[model samples]
Target chain A: MLLEIKNLQASVEGKQILHGINLTINEGEIHAIMGPNGSGKSTLSQVLAGRDTYEVNAGEVNFLGKDLLDMEPEERACAGLFMAFQYPVEIPGVNSTYFLKAAYNEMRKSRGLPEVDAMDFLTLVKEKMKIMELDQSLLNRAVNQGFSGGEKKKNEIFQMAVLEPKLAILDETDSGLDIDALKNVSEGVNKLKSKENGFLLITHYQRLLDYIVPDFVHVLYKGKIVRSGTKELALELEERGYDWIIQEASEKSVVA
Target chain B: MMSTTLPTESKEMHPYTERFNQLEASEWALDPSWLNQLRRAGIAHFAEKGIPSIREEEYRFTNLKPIENQTFDFCCGAPVADPGVSQVQGFCFDQLDAYRVVLVNGQFSKDLSDLSGLPEGCIVESLNEAVRNREDLVQGRLGTQVKVDQSSLAALNTAFFGDGLFIHVKKNLILEKPIQIIQLTANGDEGSNPVASHPRLLAIAESGASFSLVERCVGDRDTAYWVNSVSEFFVAPNASVEHLKVQEESLQAYHTAAIQAYLEQDARFTSHSMAVGAGISRNDIHSILDGKNSEAVLNGLYLGQKNQLVDHHTLMDHKQPNCNSHEYYHGILTDDSRGVFNGKIYVHQIAQKTDAIQNSRNLVLSDRATVNSKPQLEIFADDVRCTHGATIGQLDEDSVFYLRARGINEARARRMLIHAFASDVVDRIPYQAVKDYLENILADRFDPKD
Candidate 1:
């Protein structure tokens, strides 16, 4: 397995968010996490990325044979874990392309590899930007400083493309995206996927999953994975809505 | 009466002892009757004030121990050695090829200076020469505008200053090339006393005339030095002047500089001061809107490292109606260094429709670094728009992590972000050459190991 999370429990600022999350994804598998608002979807991705704001109270996250909980956020990224944030940060006065290149070289250095020089890095980003169909000006602007919601989302995906990871986590990447943006970002993620990498797509609506089909679908409710199923389960949930799932889970718990 | 009752001897004088005495009793004192009177009064003022201590409000942020302990002799009046002026690489300035004046050790050097391509009616010369040759002009405008009582540093400058640059732009004249004043202080011997140099400036922009002045202060390394300087700028009706003060004083020196600018009716003045210097330094600036419909802009940046202490005090006085001023200063303090910023805006009762904004932001790179920022407004006018804010904090951890995640090491990431933070303020400076030079010096101060 590339990533294994067993009985995960986490909290932020003393309030519990993730209660119990048990899941495993093999190297070439893509899992989609669908849930309602405030269902700990973002908290999961943040915890996996080692964001300091959230504390993993009780859990074991193993990635590539190393305990993920002990590493820093940057170390997690260097260990081939990537997270596309829901609200990307804007760092004024730092060019977007330069920031991306620095991030990439930092990850490379952690992996004991030589850094790419300016000419080489520019050529790499130029090609990636073309694939994403992003404007050339996007690379020159201060990182996400004046970008629109859709543009910021696309930039996040562009960054993900630049920093290829083994287990990529897309946390509501389609939240602010329009039809065209959603399609471009989904295509970019798909193109970046390969046999050596896996993905965790977290979303609210079922719209994003229509483009990036998942091998396994999990329904999260109140910080716990209430149900797990195949791709067909996503269709059933989309057709029946989350109300029925909530009712069924409550009824089953009462019976037990 | 005061001179007769005074004590005969004072505590051991600072090194350039004889030069200081000669500067005190020069023949120029007898040449100009008005200057003689002003000198005596200024000396009395300085004697009363002396060097300020921490108890004084203006000197609260900076300690004067280093300056008080160092006894500096006036540098030997040798000519400036051949230190070639090279164009700052990677920046282009087609407009900087104009009139220029160079100063070494508070005195003008005509050999190393150039003022050939200047427009008509533009007079740029030494202050002493101008005082003797153009007595009517010098005597009429010398110390009447910038009040000496407003600044102790200004008062001290008036008391002991010997020579400095004097510039005048006649009515309706537009100077194409900026009149550049570069002050160079060479190193003294290893065991010799430190040198104390004071360079003064008097700039006047006549009615409807527009021009720019750029000043550069540089000192040699390894030897301790002291540079106490003051500049007085006058902008006449409907005229505009842009003054830029660039200080890259040696990291081992102590510097004190003051800039006072006065604007008349419909005048526009934009001033910028970039300080990346000193073991201990203080910059005092005051801009008075003496005219209706005048506007002023003040922008500053100071980067301090190790044990350096940098203090900046600014005041904007809105004496008339419909005047606007914008002030912004940023400090990047690292390695136990300290930064202080105190800015005040005073709007008088007659000064309605005043719009002023002030902001001071600091980035503390080390845990031991410190910053004290305060903004004060005393407005008697009801119809005024003034806002002030200050912020001091460390570099954002998320931003650092974001950069590191991509592949940069922790140190490189921190340095790049700091460079970005400081470059934001540097970009506003109009002179490309000075901006580039500041960047080079800042980069060196940022990472000495690298």
Candidate 2:
């Protein structure tokens, strides 16, 4: 298994967000997690990325056969865990090329690889820019500063393409993208997908899954995964909506 | 407004009065009569005003009681051996191709200076030499630009200054290489009292002339020394001058400096003041737009760590019509250090169409670090545009997380953000070598420990 979480319970600021959650992902598999607003979808992604604010009350997260909960956020990235944020931050006065090069070189250094010089780094970044259809000028400008919403999302995918993590957790990457941007972003993700890596896509709508198909789907309701099924489960949720799942979870709790 | 009060009888004038009375006419190489007269006037002014107090509005944040209470021995002669020019090779902008002037213990060293191949009609000589040979040039512009009565420190420097430089850029001439002045303070033999030096510099850029000047102050090690320096610039019509002052004195030193410039019609002045040293330091810069269509740009950056205290005071006066002025200063403090930035822009009643902007931003890294920033603008003309603002803040947690999420460690991420914040002022520098040197220094000083 690329990632395994057993009985994960986490809270932020005195409020519990994830309660008794269990999930597993194998290599080359893409799992789509569909949920309504505030159903702990984004929280799960954040917890797996090792955000400090979210306190893990009781949980076990193993990545590549090692304990992932004990490591720092940067260590997790170096160990091949990538997270595409819902709202990418704007870092003024730091150019995109410099930031990306530093990130890539740091990861390489952690893995005992020879660092790439400025010339070679520039050439490599240019080749990756074509995949995201990003303008070459963006590399010279400040990181994500004054970028359109669609452009910011595209930049996130562009960064993921360059980093190439083993397990990628994308949090609501399709929230604000237009139709064309959605198609382009999906195509970029599809190109980077391979049999050696796994993906866990947390999204609210089923529109993103239509472009990049998922092998399995899960319904998350009230801080826990209520049900699990195949790809058809996403379509069912899209058509009938999340009221049924939420109602079923409430009734089950009442009966208990 | 000039007060004729004799400071000899004042209670605050005792220490300085005794020191002034001990000076002899034969001690200096300049014209004895004129020099004595100027020194007497300066001492009287200093005694009348005494030291600046925190109760005063202009000096509310900076307290100079420590310097005022301690009696420092004046370094009349070279007491320490010349450590040679190679001693300062590790300092900033040392490798740049320029006319180099070296000063050790407030005395000019000809062996360490390289003044060959200087352009014709340009003069780069010691102030002592200029005072003896070119008396007319030094007499008219020496103590005319700055008001000694307003600043007791400047008055004190004028009274007891031992040595410095005199630079003259002739009409319509442009210097291909920049002029660099390096000041090194060496400690006295094993166990002695703290020494003090007062160095004065004067530079005149004639009409249509242009040049760049870099002045650096560095010490061998952490020593208890006091340096009170002052520089005056006289820029003629259509002249352009870029002046950069880098102060990296010893951590145990007390440094205070002032730069006063007067601009003629259509003249331009740009200055960058970077202070990253001393236990306590203060830099005061005053620029006067005395003629029409002149411009001035002032940029400053200061970094303090441990118990260091850095203070900066600046004034931009728009006295004529159709002039522009802009000032930006940034400070970063860590540990128990404190920083102060006070900048003001004044527009005269006849100075219509004046454009002025002043901004002061500070970043405090530790809970104990503190910063006091005040930006003021007084505009008398109705057609002028003026704005001033100040901001004191800390590093953003979100920005730090953004870098850490990209695989950079927490320490490196914090360093990068701080560098980015400080780079805004450094990026405005037009000299490549100076910019690169400053960036390297910033990295070495602020880099995270392993």
Candidate 3:
């Protein structure tokens, strides 16, 4: 298993957001988590990424046969756990190329490999920029500063391409993208997917899944996964709103 | 303003006053008749004002006890065999084809300076030479801009200033390259007593002339010295001047400098000052828009760590109508350091249609670090627009996590954000060499081990 979360329970500021979340993923598998607003979709992603604000009350997250919760955010990233933020930060004065090179060199240093030279690194960045259809001028500008919503999302995927990870979790990557941007982002993700890597895509709408099909889809309601099914489950949920699943979960809780 | 009489008793006299009285009779006081008169007037003014104490409103946040308690011998005619020219060559703008003036230990080094291809009718020489040759220019504008009665330090500097740069750009002449003035201070001997140097600079740009000036101050890191510098600029009508001042003295040094500019009608002036060194430093800048439709912009950035204390005080006086002024200053404090910023914009009653804005931003990187920011605007004109604001904050947690999730360590992420905060002021600089030099210094400071 690439990632295994058993009975995950987390909270923020003393309010429990994730009561219990249990999920599993294997190599080369693309798992889509579809949920309505305030269904703990983002909470799950933040908890897995080791965000300090969210406290993991009780649960064990194992990644590649090691405890994922025991490592820092950067350590988790170096250990092949990458997370794409919903709203990418705008860091002024930090050039895009410089930041990426530093991150890439750090990862290489951790893996006991020699550092990449500036010329080689530039070539690699240029090649990856083509995959995301990013402007070459963006390399000279500050990181995400003055970039449009669609460009910001594309930049996230571009970063994922640069730093190849074993398990990647993208939280609401399709929130603010246009149709063309959505297609471009989906295409970038599809090209990076391989048998050696896995993806856990947390999104709200089913439109994104149409471009990049998922092997399995799960319905998250009120901090718990109410039901799990195959790819068809996403289409069913898209056609009929999430009221039915939410109503069923409450009724089941009363009966129990 | 309150006026207090000076004590007559010798014991009650300020230490600096006593030092000035003794130094006034020395042979170094020999100069032209007008220069001697200027020095005498400076000493008399300093004697009455003495050293400014925290009791005064202008010196409320800064204490001069450290400077008041100790006595620093003046360095005069000190022969420096080698002023570490090669070491400073790396810090200079050698890539740019420009005339260079190098001053070591408050004395000009003609051998190290390169003034070969200066423009015709332009004067680039030492202040001592200017006092002898161009007496009319030196006597007309040397002590007119700064008020010696208000600042005791300025008075002291006027009385004891030995040698500095004298730059004059003739009327209707535009220079192709910027002029770079580099000042390097070092102890006369290893492990010697503390020394001090007061360098005075006077730059004049005639009407219809344009030029750029870059002044840098650097010192030996291991020495304990005091550098009290005063600079005055005279911008004639319709002339434009861009000034860049970078102060990177020793960590154990005491630096108190002031720059005052007088702008005539339709003149344009912009200054960028960056302070990154000294244990305790204060920079005072005052710009007076005495001409109609003149514009002035002041930008500054200061970075402090450990026990360093950095203070910046600026004043923009709109004395004429249809003038505009903008000021932006930022500071980053870490460890137990403290930062202070106080900016004021004053518009007179006759100065109608004046537009002015002042903003100060500070980022505190440690729990113990502190910053005090105050932006004041006083407008007596009914048809003026004046706004001022200040903000003190820490690095945005969201920004930090964003970088961390991208595989950057905590320390590096914090440094990147701090650099971003400082770059806002640095980006306004037009000179490529100055920009590159500041960026490298910021990088080295953030990642010291590297």
Provide the overall lDDT of each model, using Cα atoms, as 2-decimal numbers: 0.82, 0.86, 0.86
In order, the candidates keep a fraction of the true contacts of 0.48, 0.60, 0.83
Report lDDT (Cα) of residue A193, candidate 3.
97
For candidate 2, write residues B227-274 as lDDT tens digits: 888889999999988899889999988899989889999999999999
* TM-score per model (chain B): 0.90, 0.94, 0.93
Clashes of 1: 9
**Candidate 2 Cα errors over 4 Å, as ranges:** B1-13, B28-35, B76-81, B88-94
**Residue A12, candidate 3: alpha-carbon lDDT:** 94
The weakest ten consecutive residues by lDDT in model 2 chain B span B1-10
Q: Candidate 3 falls in which docking quality class?
A: medium
DockQ of 3: 0.74
Residue pairs that clash (backbone atoms under 3 angstroms), model 1? A103-B406, A103-B407, A104-B406, A105-B407, A106-B407, A106-B408, A107-B407, B16-B72, B16-B73
Instruction: Report the lDDT of model 2 for residue B417.
Output: 86
Identify the leading candidate in terms of TM-score: 2
Q: Mind giving the per-residue lDDT tens digits that candidate 2 earns over A145-236?
A: 99999999999999998898999888999999999999999999999899999999999999999998999899888789999998899999
Deviation of model 1 at A129, angstroms = 4.5
Q: What fraction of the reference structure's interface contacts does model 3 contain?
A: 0.83
Ten residues in a row with the worst lDDT in model 1 chain B? B86-95
Candidate 1 lDDT over B152-177, as tens digits, reads: 55666666667788889999998877
